[model samples]
Target chain A: MENLLGIAIGAILINNIVLTKFLGLCPFFGVSTRLKNATTMGLAVTFVMTASSILTWLVYEYLLVPLHIQYMRIVVFILVIASFVQLTEMFIKASSPTLHRSLGIYLPLITTNCAILGVTLMNTVVEGYSLIAATVNGVATGVGFILALVLMAGLRERLELADPPQAFQGLPLAFISAALLALAFQGFSGMIL
Target chain B: MKFQEFTKGIIKNNAVFALALGLCPTLAITTSVENALGMSLAFAFVLISSNLIISALKRFIPQEVRIPCFIVIIASLVTAIDLFIHGYSPTLYEHLGIFLPLIVVNCIILGRAEAFASKHSVSDTFLDAAGVSVGFALAIISVSAIRELLGSGTIVIFGHEVVPAFTSSPAVVMLLPPGAFLTIGILLALLKRAKVI
Candidate 1:
């Protein structure tokens, strides 16, 4: 239990997927302008990451490792993620039209989002976490991503009222803000587990 | 062999700066010039090969499953490159870490395949891929050069000190995540001011 807590805290605070690891940056900048959209995108990513982590863990432990075809993980993991995203899109479209409408294009975009693949690959290959640990880490990473996205969205919304220089209007300003946020997140590195 | 196809990706539609397609690897593996060079080489290999294959087989791949087909091709290429790097250059492979495999998800490769390769001829797609890869290489190497110089006070490439240390103490922040963002942000602002990007 203590180990699980450490993993969760480490993933959320220390090794944040977006701020630290630099995964899933497209959605970080693209869908972060609005708080609602950021939240929706975050939830969608969390769902996919968690689901794919477990599924990939199973495949890695049971199928790939036994067959000695671990080199095929990149192709296998991505195909799984693409299929999973497709299934989720279909389910959302059928079950919840409003949520589907809100998600819109971002739903499909999650398939290409590197964060989902990063977490799955990291959990299995890098960290070598077990099935349950992988799931926990995936959820924690998603929450960390949400935390960063929400914070950035709030700052961007506030920036709308302030005037910046002509050269630093849109993306340049956002990059600067992200730099500061990244600086702040760095302070969490020394925290004791 | 249109000249415009080769020239456009360098400045007009740079994958990194203008289009902002593959920021993940752009920020992640660009800690040193050596890593940046290795990454650019690998990326160029995958991009050019995948573009060639996709453009050649564009007529056969169904429209509905084109994305998946493109992905499978890109992923297989990445895996081959990953194994080759691991076998040949263990140190660089270790330095690159997961970003090497993460190349499969780099939007630049897939974006090019879907947008240009699917529509253009084989030779045109080849030039397009080469141009975009060059653009990406320039962007990442520039970023990595600035980061390494300011962060570590030296520029080392392939076990050689290209730039001697200017100061004993450098701003270590430039080596961290914030440094990557700050460098890219300031670079973008400068490019805008000069109207270069």
Candidate 2:
């Protein structure tokens, strides 16, 4: 339906989880040093976000609502997200050793990533999206994160050669680049379906 | 020695400026000074309490399950603070939104639990957490102040105009996502240039 498409587009561009929502920023700045690492982190986060969104939505609707402990959402949603991150780590380790190694450093970091948990909570608590809608939002948000990170990676890859002031050499320069990128992305706001 | 541990977190090992560990809340709720203060209070509460409990129970938590345990403690604390703040100030609660609860996943809290609290004694952990919390508070407050002043042309705290508008045409971007990055990015750079970081 058009509604779903709107949600997907809205998440990916208009409300980009990374550039706008300020979620998963740790990896956004940390792992974005290289295209390979950035893409891998993006895919991993996308997987976890989609899986956790579905799971958390179901839990919120089925368990939390029925139990009348909706206030326990923070505690409940985080446990669910942490468990899923663990499962993804284990699965990746077993299925693809290379990816596991490539993503190994970031896997643990993802557990603490506010982006994954932030989206899940947003889907269930804030936006109140249905399961299908929540899943789409999650996937789209992940895609958004990937888009931002990959773009940043490409930019930073070239930034390595550019000579800036002594103070603006490393993260300072990266943050400035992100500012411009975010300003560019800010133009995407307020688009209608 | 204990005083040194607390003092170091302010500058030498600042959670936000040096480590860049607490970027989520630093950017999300820092649109205004009040929001920043509310968030800092909530963050300090969860971090300090979690550090105290985790340090006390670190030995029994078992190495394998310590992370999950730290998470549970921190999440429970966040939920409590979230509810309490909502009841106390519906306005602040609404402004904070999901970022309030997202404190459970803030890397600064978890990173400290793993690196410092789990290793040190309870008192040491408490001082360390307090220091890091203060450092984080200072960083967020400064960023929020900069954003509000430049973006809004004034500084208002708790409904009072503490600082009047200086510019008729403020750089509104300072109040947006880019502003957060710009503020912190330049802050870090200036600190580096002055050897303050």
Candidate 3:
């Protein structure tokens, strides 16, 4: 239990997906313009990430290890993610028209978001997480992504009105802000249980 | 028809500077000159081979299945390159680590396939791939050069320390993840000011 708490806290604060790992940057810049869309996109990614982590964990431990085809994990994980995104898109379109409309644009992009793949890959590659640990990391990473994105969106919403030079108007300003935010997150790196 | 398609990717639509795609690898692995070179060479090989194969077979592949097809081709090439790097240059392979295999999903490769390769002729597609790969390599090298020099107080390339250590205390912040953002952020502003980007 203590180990799990450490993993969760470490993932959420220390190894944040967007701020630290630099994954899912496309949406970090694109969909972060509005709070509504930011929340919707965050929730969408959270669902898919958690679900895919569970499924991929099963495949990795049962199928890949037993088959001795670990090199194929990349190909396998991507296919699973792509298909899962497709299925989720379909389900959203069929089930919740309102939520679907809000999240429609981000759904397809999530296929290439890299954060999803990064989480799954991190499970197998970096952390070497077990099945439960992978699920926890996946969900926690999703939370971390949400935390970063929401904070960015909130700040960007205010930054639009701030006075800035012409050259540093748009994406450049965002990068600077992200740099500061990343630096702030560094303070959490030393946290210990 | 040929040169235009190829040349466009180099300057007008340079993947990193203009398109803003593939920022992850562009920022992450570019902490050192050696990592930058290794990554660029790996990406160049994969981008060229994948684009060529995709263009050659674009006619047979259905539009709906194009993405999966492109991904499979890219993943296979990345795996092959990953294995080759591991066998030949264990040091470079170790330094690159996950980013090496993560190249499979680097949007630049797939973006080129979707945007140019699927529509252009085989020769044209090859040129586009080469141009974009070169452009990406240039961007990574330049960023890594700045970061490595300031962050570490020395310049090292391909496992050889080329420059003497400059300062006892470098700005260690420039070596961390935040430093990547700061470096690129400032570079982008400077480039825009000079109208280079």
Candidate 4:
């Protein structure tokens, strides 16, 4: 239980998927243009990250490791993520069209988001997390990603209103803002589990 | 044909600055010049080989199943690279670790395979892949140089000290994750100010 809490906190704050680990950055900048879209993308990612981590963990421990073909993880993991996205699309279309439309294109983009793959890989390879531990870490990391995205979206909205020099207008300015935010988050690095 | 392939990737359609693909390594590995060079070479090996094979076998692969096909070929190449790196350069292999295999999912390789290689000739595809890889290497290495010097107060490459240490305790954040973000963020702004990117 203590280990579980530590992993969750560490994943969310100490080793944040976006701000700290540098995982899932594409969506951090891409989908963060609007608050609503950011929330929807966050929820969608949370769902996928949790599901895929569990799936990958079970496969790695039972199937890949036992078979002595750990090299196949990249192939297997990608195939699983691609197919899982397709499956989620079908399920959402059938079960919740409104939610599906809300998510729209971001749902497909989730397939490429490195956070999901990063968590799964970190769970199996880096931390040697068990199936349950991987699931917890996965969900926590997703929540962390969502937190970073929301924070970034809020700041970006404000930046759009603020005056800036010509050179820092678009992506460049966005990056500068991220730099400041990252500096602030560095304070959390010293937190004790 | 030669210039078309080379120029497309270097500037106009440069993978990092222009295309904005593959930001993970662009941020993570750029913390050190050594890691940056290692990653770029690793990525180049995977990208060029995958492009050639995928381009050569373009006809046999079905459109409906093309993504999966490209992934398998790319994954095999990544696995091969992963093993070779582990065997030859254990230190680099340790530093690169997950990022190495994660190359299989890097949108750049699959993006090029789907967008360029699937339709272009094998030779042109090779050039395109090489150009993009070099362009990416340039970006990563440059960022790493700035971060290593600033974040660590010294620049060391492959266990050889290139410069004397200026301070005992460097900022150290530059070696951390957020520092990666901050460094790239500022660097991008500087480039924009110079109108280079």
Candidate 5:
């Protein structure tokens, strides 16, 4: 239990998917234009990350290890992620049309988001966590992705009004803001140990 | 073969600075110039090889299944490089870590395969891939130079000290995640101000 909590906290704050680890940055800047969009993207990512981590973990332990084709993991994990993303998109479309409309656009994007794939590889290949531990880390990393997105979204909403230089208007400024946010997140490293 | 096909990716369609296509590795593996070069080599191999194969086989791959087809091609290439790096330079492989395998999902590679290589001829696709790979290399290396110099007050490229210790106490944050963000952010702004990007 203590180990699980440590994994959760470490993934969420210490090694945050976006702020520190630098995973899922495309969506961090892309979908962070609004709070609502950010929340929807975050939730969508959480669903996929948690599901795919478990799926990939099971595959790695049972399939890859048994076959002794550990090097095939890179190819296998990505294929699994891409297909799972497609599956989630179809499922959402069938289950709820409105939710699908909003979240569907982001689903395809998530396949390349890196956070989902990063967490899966971390679970099975890097960290070798158990199935439950993998699930916790996946969800916690998604929460971290969400936290960074929400924080950046709130900052961006206000940043548009406080105009800086012309060259620093768009993504350059966003990058700068992210640098500050990352610096703030650096504080969390001490909190853990 | 028009030279513009190659030049455009270097400037107009730069994967990192102008388009911001692959920020994950642009930030993650760029702590040292050596790692930046190693990543560029691996990235260039995958991008170049994948573009050639995808372009050559574009007609054979059905439109409905092109994306999956491209994923498989790219993933296999990445796996090959993963093994190559692991055997050739264990230190670089260690430093690169997950980012090495993570290249299979990099948006730039897949994005180019789907958008450019799928439509253009094989030769043109090769040039386009080369140009973009150079652009990515330039961006990542520049970020690494700034970080290594500022954070450590020294720059070493493959055991040769390019920039010696310039400061008694360097700002260590430049080696951290914030440093990657700040370096690229300011570099982009400066390029914009200079009308470069």
Candidate 6:
């Protein structure tokens, strides 16, 4: 239990997907302009990451390991993520048209989000976590991603009012803000657990 | 006409600076010039091969499953390069870590396939790939050069000290995550100021 808590805290605070690992940066900068969109995108990515992590864990443990074709994980894992995103898109379209409409292109874009694939692949291949651990880690990573996105969105929202130079108006300033946030997160790296 | 397609990717539609498509590898593995060079080679290999194959097969591929098809091809190419690096250069393989496989999701490759290669001729696609790859290489190499030189007080390329230590103690923070962002941030601002981007 203590180990699980450590993993959760470590993933959320220390090894944040966006602020630290630099994964899923497309949406990090693109959709994070608005708080609502950032939250929605965050939740959507969390769902995909968690779902794909569980499914990939099963595939890696049962099928790939048994077949000795573990090297094919890159191809297999991406296909799984793409299909999963497609399925989720269709389900949302049928059940909650409003949610689907709100998501817009970002829903489909989730298929290409490296953070989803990163978490899935990291859980199975790099860390070799157990099923429970992988699921927990996936959720924690998503939470970390959400935390970073929401914070960035809030910052960017206010940045709209601030006047700066022409060159650093948009993305350049956003990146500098992210740099500060990343520096602050660096302090968390020393925390024990 | 041919040269136009090639040159555009290098400057007009640079995968890193102008497009910002593949930041994962750009920021993750650029701690040193050696890693940057190794990554650029592997990225170029995958990008060029995948673009050529996808462009050649664009018409035959069904419209409904085009994304998945493109992904499979890219993934296979990434795996091939990944394995080749592991076998031939163990040190680079270790340095790249997961960012290598993560290249499968690098938007640049898939973005090129979908945006340009899927519609263009094979020759055109080849030039586009080469141009984009070179552009990406230049961007990452420059970023890595700045980071490695200032952060570590030296620049080491493939085991040789290209730039000797400038200071006894460097600003080690420049080698961390913030430094990557800071470098790119300032670089982007400078490019914007000069209208280079």
lDDT string, candidate 2, A39-133, tens digits: 99899889888998999999999999999999999888988988888888899899999988888888888888899899988898888888899
Predicted candidate 6 versus true structure: per-residue lDDT over A64-101, tens digit per residue: 99999999999999998998889898998999999889
Give the winner by DockQ: 5
The TM-score, computed over Cα atoms with residue i paired to residue i, of candidate 4 is 0.96
Tens-digit lDDT string for candidate 4 (B57-158): 999999998987998898889889999999999999998867888887788988999999999999999989999998888888888988899898989998
TM-score of each: 0.99, 0.98, 0.97, 0.96, 0.98, 0.98
RMSD from true fold, candidate 4: 1.6
* Pick by DockQ: 2 or 5, better one: 5
lDDT of 6 at A92: 86
Any runs in candidate 4 off by more than 4 Å, and if so which? none
B1-197, model 1: which lDDT tens digit per residue?
89789889997788888877899988988889999999999999999999999999999999999999999999999999999999999998998999999999998999999999999999999999999999999999999999999999999998799999899999899989999999999988888889988
For residues B44-146, write the lDDT of model 6, one tens digit per residue.
9999999999999998999888999999999999999999999999999999998999999998989999999999999999999999999999999999999
Candidate 3 ranges beyond 4 A from true positions: none
Error in Å for residue B157 of model 6: 0.6
Q: Could you give the CAPRI-style class of model 6?
A: high
TM-score of 6: 0.98
> What is candidate 6's local distance difference test score?
0.92
lDDT of 3 at B45: 100
What is the per-residue lDDT of model 5 for residues A1-193, given as tens digits with 9 covering 90 to 100?
Answer: 4399889899989999998999999999999989899999999999999999999999999999999999999889888999999988888899999999898789999988888889999998888898999999989998988999999999999998997999998999999999999999998987753
- Model 1 alpha-carbon drift over 4 Å, by segment: none
DockQ of each: 0.88, 0.88, 0.72, 0.68, 0.89, 0.87
Model 4: what is its DockQ? 0.68
Judged by DockQ cut-offs, the docking class of candidate 3 is medium
Per-residue CA lDDT of model 3 for B9-58, tens digit only, reads 77677888777888888778888999999999999999999999999998
